[model samples]
Target: MNFEVVLTCAVTGAGDTTGRSKHVPVTPEEIARDAVEAARAGASVVHLHVRDPQTGKGSRDPALFRETVDRVRQSGVDVVINLTAGMGGDWTPAKDDWAMPGPGTDMIGPDERLAHVRDCLPEICSLDCGTLNFGNDDTIYISTPPILRRMAALVREWGVKPELEVFDLGHIRFAKAMLAEGLLADPPMFQLCLGIPWGADQTVETMAAMKAQLPPGASWAGFGISRMQMPMAAAAVALGGNVRVGLEDNLFLGRGVLATNAQLVEQAREIIERMGARVLSPQEARNRLHLRGADA
Candidate 1:
């Protein structure tokens, strides 16, 4: 397998990881700074998800996205910006006899979910291809086929590269169907999300299976949460795929060693290099992924 790998740093995920690790970027300024740092540390791309400034929780607010993107652009880094269009899909079961939404449900239509991406128009935006049982209890990620189709169509219309995100085998199948329907543009890109609870297991076998399922000529990357990050990085490279890492997926440089996003990116770059792989620069990644230029 060729070793031309591209590293993507997930700057701040829409999870409760901030509270778990103080290194997780919270404010827009902090997130942007982290993105620049990750670029300096050898990440060609930065996947961003903005949080509410006051509460430090995940948010779908377009203004928050505006501030975060503006800050990252002003930093003058060459890293490609990948905004999250995966929010507003959380669904918590109803407490009062399953008739209404419970405490943490934030489900909404596809358009509402992609509002930030439409407004910001980042170089790339994620499109979750399918839904599954997410998190601990009573939570179901509600990405039905119709919703995914609508989101994919919208993403294509907006002239943004949709990073098809797959958390399980079924999601990959769904993504392929979308491709067959001409919803996704040419040379489709995918992100295999591993180790999420009730999702695909973070094993070498699973990664290989998912990678093999991608459409012919597809450009793809993979990430694993928590302790699986480094192993999955190596696995992806070994399987002729790209890799991603960041505090959003893991909090430690090692056991009990707190890590920043830059630290994680640096580690990933080292691993890729040691595996006889050359890490792609931002421009190279842009070309490989068919992403728009900074000025575009």
Candidate 2:
């Protein structure tokens, strides 16, 4: 078992949960505050995604990302910031013409997607390795091979570690291919995102299968959405991997119990401690992941 675990708090995701729970941070200030609080609550890293303050929708705006990152850095916290480069890839086809994108489509080139990474120079940024049906019918998330390669190369160029986001088995395969092609560095980091519809299910069998497929010596974490958040964190820890938790993946502390980012981090920390493992500090996590400080 991995005795020392790195816990990541996903401060606010691109999910439309703002109306469902008022705790989801919408503005840059709110997002930064939650990230700092989560770090103080035992999160070694904070995965971030900015949302439109007025509409509560997901955004890929570099200005918003800069504001949030700046606030977090200015707070004097030492937590690792893992920004999401998984935006600008939602492709919902048009009803009349399949080639044309519909109202929900937000697809863009690789450069636009990583604009924030270049601007912020975060220590870590995610690169979704494959395209898949995102949610309901007709909605697809398009992360083509060429796009991923371009994004990965840019991430390397920026001197930031790529947290390869794998939502399914094929995505893992693509990640390995990218590694073989020299698009990623050694000891690549992965996030086994389970429990999303049309992707991998939240079960031990699925987690074990995906974990087994990871490259040897790769540092990885796993997370489950909704009610399976805590359960998946425990599973990941027990299976010799790190864990992720927060409002991004789950909103409730218990049945109908709304949770803040700090509370979720604390809850995961308690579970890790009770399970005979230690939650790593940000510096310790950086060392384990072979990352220099963001300032470096």
Candidate 3:
């Protein structure tokens, strides 16, 4: 097991989870508040996704991102910020004509997809490595090679680290190719995304398999959705990797018990401590991962 772990709390995801949990932050103020609270509860990093306050849906609006990041920065918390660059790739084809776009389609070019990342300039922004059938529906998340290369280059140019989000082995393979092409910087960062449909399963074996494929000296974290969140975090720790947790992935602190972002971070911290691992501070994480730092 790794002696030191960087714990990340994904404050609020763009999923349909607000109705189920009142603790889910919807507005910039709420998201920022929870992110600060989570940091105080022992989260080294707070991964963020802006939501439309009126509709409680995920949004890629740069204004919303700016407000959220500003609030977090001004809150006096010293945690590292990580913004999501995984939106604007939803594609739900029309039933009648597969050739035409559908109601759920919100596909855009790489530049537009990274609009919020450019607007916020967080220390880390996610880059989903490939396309996948999202949520067992007609919806598919697209991130082709050309688009990923461009996005990686742009983030590198901006001095923002791209957290390569790999959902499966193939995604890891492609991410390796990107690294080979010199699109990613040294000591590449990775997020092993699991439990989503059509992606890798939420299990120790799966996380281990995916972790084995990462490039040497890469900094990585792994997370599983729903009930497997904490288990996967423990598994990640045991496998010599970092951990990610929050309401963005799991909603319950226990069976029939709803969780807030801070609560989730607290629980993950407890697990890490019980396993005899130290939770790294934001600066420690920055130094260990070779990040561009919080100011960047």
For 1-296, candidate 3 gives per-residue lDDT tens digits of 88899999999999999999999999999999999999999999999999999999999999999999999999998999999999989999999999988998999999999998887898999999999998878999999999999999999999999999999899999999999999999889999999999899999999999998999999999999999999999999999999999999999999999999999999999999999999999999888878886334
* Tens digits of lDDT, candidate 1, 139-186: 888899999999999989988999999999899999999999999998
Backbone clash count for every predicted candidate, in the order shown: 0, 0, 0
lDDT of 2 by residue, 1-296 (tens): 77999999999999889999989999999999999999999999999999998999999999999999999999998899999999999988899999999989998999999999999999999888899888877989999999999999998988899999999999999999999999899989999999888899999789999999999999999999889999999999999999999999999999989999999999999999999999999999998997757224
Candidate 3 lands at a TM-score of: 0.98
- TM agreement with the true structure for every prediction: 0.97, 0.98, 0.98
Report every candidate's CA lDDT. 0.90, 0.94, 0.94
User: Which scores higher on lDDT, 1 or 2?
Assistant: 2
Candidate 2: list runs displaced more than 4 Å. Answer: 294-296
Which 10 successive residues of model 2 have the least lDDT summed? Answer: 287-296
